[model samples]
Target: MMMVIVSYDVKTSDPDGAKRLRHIAKICQNYGVRVQNSVFECLVDTANLELLKEKLLDQIDETKDSLYFFNIGKKYHHKIEKFGSKDVIDLDGPIIF
Candidate 1:
């Protein structure tokens, strides 16, 4: 699987904008983990990545919102650096309830 960093900026001045923001977040959550308020770290294959992109694009308003996807490839462990209080989740590790 490849690592994908997804980020978005949604126009939240109205009710619809807020709804859209939630919808976008929900979609991302289905595919990965949220590292920040509007950033997510997703580990998926090429086909799933394309599907994620399409879903995100459909939720965004092109004129008012913006979305980004940074493909970090398979060798992504050393590419990322984090210095914060929140613990990072290993995408390749086992999941526990």
Candidate 2:
């Protein structure tokens, strides 16, 4: 499968920038994308990556902000490595004393 990682870096203040970022992230998520911080990563098996790029570009326009995205071109060799990583805390386990 083909995996994509897009690191977005836009020049704007925290609040406005973050708001736009969140809006774009939502668009990506709506397209079945897996996001991490400003990075949007997802795995798919297709002859090309056009669909993915299109979704991201739409997000850029949706937020009325500039954005950057590209395919990291890393392949998911196996299922054990996991698909994507995020900043979420591990809520499945118990806390230690």
- Please, what's the RMSD in Å of model 2? 7.8
Q: What is the lDDT of residue 9 in candidate 1?
A: 99
Residue lDDT tens for model 1, 32-90:
99999999999999999999999999999999999999999999999999998989999
Judged by whole-model lDDT over C-alpha atoms, candidate 1 comes out at: 0.97
TM-scores across all candidates? 0.98, 0.47
| Count of backbone clashes, every candidate in sequence | 0, 0
Shift in Å, residue 94, candidate 2? 23
Encode model 2's per-residue lDDT on 1-97: one tens digit a residue. Answer: 5565556655456677676667667766644345555665555545445676676565553444665555544543332234455443222235354
**Which pairs clash (backbone N, Cα, C closer than 3 Å) in model 1?**
none
Question: Candidate 1, which segments miss by more than 4 Å at Cα?
Answer: none
Positional deviation of residue 66's Cα in model 1 after best superposition, in angstroms: 0.6
Error of 2 at 22 (Å): 1.8
